[model samples]
Target: MEQLARLEDLPQTYIDHLTQSNLVPLWPSLRNVLPPKQPVPLTKATAWHYRDIKPLLLEAGELTPIEKAERRVLVLANPGHGLENMKATSSIYLGMQLLLPNEWAPSHRHTPNAVRLVVEGKGAFTTVEGQKCIMEHGDLILTPSGLWHEHGHDGDEPVIWLDVLDLPLVYYMEASYVEGGDVQQVQGTDLGHHYAKGVVPTVHFVRQNANFPLLRYAWTDTKNVLDALAADANHQAPAQVSFINPETGQDCQNIIGYSAIRVAPNETVQLTRRSAAQIFHVIEGQLSITVNSDHFDLARSDTACASCFAQIDLINRSEQPAYVFVADEAPLQKKLGLYSTRPRSV
Candidate 1:
């Protein structure tokens, strides 16, 4: 090859001439540097989402002492998304969060994919798609991605959760539209009672003997399913088990990516990095997570544990077990309908 060189011996004139001819054309133009072109403001009212807390997580002693009663978040997208310059979807993604004791974000929803996870709150709620669900902590509540949903505090304490929407997704598609519900919110108690009254109730899906598939999952029932897995001889999962729609047997929440949980509990889970970058949020307990030796001490509402295709280890130090929510494309893209665990190739 050509001899190795250093800049010290090069003449100033030669360096200047070389840089001008080689670099200026690569500089971004004024148009590229300017902000995105603002389209004509739509006449329809645009809704808003909030992330500031009624009380900071560091404020209260009890909330911070045991690390309970606080709303901590890893992601929040509204009014903007991280990759705004790359895509143009009207959908906006939000990671709404709340902690305990009187910190209610109030009732509101718009024509966007609004989804929430009851991170660590009891008696929190969302009335959506004309149905109501009491969001117990760890419950994945869906507002039909675009139906009317509102969050509130009815119990004695505060509740916090993550609210994710697809506004940016829509913005990229350039097919975003907005329309408000005729009624801002429906009564939660009424919806709750209406569902409870029916015996062997089946509203969304018909109940077959083995495949009564309407509800994606109930945490208690899933726990039992996991218990069965534990009883099995080969329960390593090396991969994780995902929730599937029983009727169609497809993954739930089409655009939300795929949701899966790993029960390694102080073990290592290998993953391959690809185009799909995920934001993993811890749902319960504490963990010592290391993404290739870049360690993260994560607990409930603490979102320090995330990586894309790096070898990750979760070490639990708490007396109780830990649960984590990982978002990634189903069946690793490289494997195509399968989870992949291979080392990165240089």
Candidate 2:
């Protein structure tokens, strides 16, 4: 009764009633829970080196067969979330997957949308709804939510790729679902037929449909477009381009966005902050990125994450040009009217 009287002078009967109803008065905790400013648990900018993890991935491949493992991926867990969760940032998940020669990852689908940026090797391919798309170094491939896809390697060497997904968003929404395909192996390899027929067939088997018409964004074509843009004298920051849907001319998916940035030797690109967080992977050469006060020096096959609303700058410090692949959730943020950017003075 005395403690109840001291708790903001609430009556003993009232306090007892609140406890019996499994409810606590909010006045005591309101200030801590609802502060004046939006409080976000900021994730620090971090980097991962492919060279350091390559051996462990190779060893895992030798020890565990693809048949038993289902998918052989090593997640790049964020330090902010601790090792329990596989998220690379608050809203994104990043991983490195390895597929040895003649091995295959069985077909399956999930609610989270994913994008694959090839890091090394070649002759590996992913099949989306029976359409096979070849995977090579620097290629970008999309695996939209709930799409039946499988991976296989026919090359002599093991193939490795960076996998970026909007899984945290799916988990947050409580919309996660997974289903395994009936067929274990991909049957179609009609790459020439897709062009010869002049019609790309859609996957009719899955319940959830994909917004983008195309799945494969070949590195050769992407590089050619970037090269043409760089040839212009007006081109600044070397070049920057987004992978868009051929039919819609928007981002490939509504949940995620993919972009490529190139920087010439000894050049720096200044960019303002935006509401969407970004993760950058260095494809070639040496690069430096400063996100607000945090600085990251990245080499080939390294990755860095910049939090939302952090002013960022990218610099190519090597003699050769640098290529970077970026993944973000700007599309979703824009759809929700939560995306904003402010220009920074150079």
Candidate 3:
């Protein structure tokens, strides 16, 4: 391997001439962009504990009312990305959003696809497009791109949900923007029941829906699926299921891929390192997460993030099985032909 030239070694007059012409050399900074073996990711192995965050999040609610704060949230910022950037990974934006009793986050839609993994409380619901999706302890709700959505809480307790969005990628492409709208009159019940077993209504005229037909994925149903997968006597593979569009069978969203993974008691599952940055949020029992060399002991509502090509291992050292909700940038990377595992052979 040869050493690359440094920008500081360049002649001052040449630098000034290039700067004046709005041009610069790539050789001096080539490795910064195209590194030796793997990507030099700004994202690092990071974890956000729910215990430390709940108090601050509640304080945010008391300090700022719903009217003043459209969405009361505390961003889970990764230090590698810089706290100011508010990014959990290279492409994902994570925030713990709160909606107090009788409070409503006004109706608005944005260009970036967003999903909410319900963390606590029950009386909160998010209306996306026209369906009213009730928020439960572990429900996964979608508010895809360009869709009208609003959050409202009917119960007395404070409701909090982890919001996952592709804001950084959309904002980078200059396509991220939001539009405010009047309060939504939630039209129908969530579409989850209709496709409960992946069965489309045949006798009745199925309501024609837009790109997103089913928005709410109940955790009970997802956990059941994972249990069934684990019970299989045929294979010993990782018990995981991808969240997909019921209609077209594609990824639930265009940019990010979401999944639910179950680790049986006293098991250690090595999640393969891929070309997409990933996040894992604990939904059930405890998990000991390892991202490369860093280890994170996660409880309910705790989250861990790993950059691309970083080794991740999830361990369930307890007596009960552990369930995790996962999100990654694979959809976008695959679409752009930049997704892959680390090469095994040199």
Candidate 4:
């Protein structure tokens, strides 16, 4: 009788109602699921040394061909997150791909926007929708969502580049799709030949398709732009330039943001914390980036990543100017009304 009375005292009506409706009340789990504040940031400040990864990349190249491997890429997986997911940060995916001379990475297109920042070698080209854009060290190339593209290397040395993609966003939205193209390599005539002849083959493609107006942001032009910006005597901490869509004059991709930041010799730039995560690749000289309270010194060809909502500061300790290629998830965050930044105290 005592046990029966205890059981009767329990909220049997509420339990029966919840089970019939297939709904679980939040009262018990609310504290665990919805906290007063963000439990913790999803990413960590991490850096990768090219010297350490180069040999491993080379070994991967020897072990598998481009076709077998699909793409010879070594992902810069974040320690905070595990490698099984292949993410550099919670919002961005970063990888280093190597293409040997005379090799080809087959044609395929996906719904996620991607950008490549060339790190080493030259004479490689990525053909997007029949327009070939030559790849050189320090160049930034774009392959927007659903754009057919293929990569091939004709240079004497192996060409390597950092591949940044909005894969996490696509995955989160469940909009990821990949379709392979029929052609393996761009046919007989190298489009690069036309480029060498001072002809822009992309003009016709750009006119035909308004979606992909730009394919390649050449390093020479980018350097010139940076130089022009730096020429101003009152130029500020980090001289920066963004890659924009030729048609919209907006970010290169609708979902991703790309920029080049130049830090003059012996200069330190204190950057505010933002709600979007960013991955940066060091192009030249030496740089020390302080994220939150942690510091990372990046050398030439090194890469570093910062988590969302963390204050960052960049310092150039070398005699020569330092350049960094940055890719971030700001565009999507801004579009969704989730973008924010707080100024850091000097």
Question: Which predicted model would earn the best lDDT?
Answer: 3
Q: Write one digit per residue (lDDT tens) for candidate 3, span 1-346.
A: 5898998999999999999999989999888888988888989899999999999999999999999999999999999989999999879999999999999999999999999999999899999877899999989999988889999999999999999999999998999899999988868989787785657656463544557877999999999999999999885769999999887789999999999999999999987779999999999999899888899999999999999988888999999999999999999999999999964221
Q: Per-residue alpha-carbon lDDT of model 2 for 1-346, expressed as tens digits?
A: 1122236678889989999999998766565566444435456677888777788889999999999899898999878878577888788999899999999898899999988899999889998877778998898888888788889888999999999999987998999888998654445552332321224446552322436567788777777777777788886654989988654478988787899988888989887677788899988777999988888889899998887777889988788888889888799989999888877645
TM-score of each: 0.60, 0.85, 0.96, 0.86
Error of 4 at 24 (Å): 4.5
Task: Extract clashing residue pairs from model 4.
Answer: none
The regions of model 4 sitting more than 4 angstroms off are: 1-39, 184-206
Q: Supply every candidate's count of residue pairs whose N, Cα or C atoms clash at under 3 angstroms.
A: 26, 0, 0, 0
Q: For candidate 1, lDDT tens digit of each residue in 1-346? A: 2333546456778768879888433223333444243222211111122213324532442445323422244344322223333211222244546544444433444544545766555766655544556777666665544445545557776566666555555565675665544434444232222222123346563322223123223455444555466457777654345555444455555554545454545544555544343545666666666655566666565543233344556676655656666654433244454344455554
**lDDT tens digits by residue: candidate 4, 86-156:** 88887788899999999989899999888889999988988877767888889888888887889988888
Shift in Å, residue 211, candidate 1: 16
Worst 10 residues of 4 by lDDT: 189-198
Clashing residue pairs in candidate 3 (N, C-alpha, C atoms within 3 angstroms): none
Better of 2 and 3 by lDDT: 3
Model 3 regions more than 4 Å off: 202-209, 343-346
RMSD of 4: 6.0
The model with the greater lDDT, 1 or 2, is 2
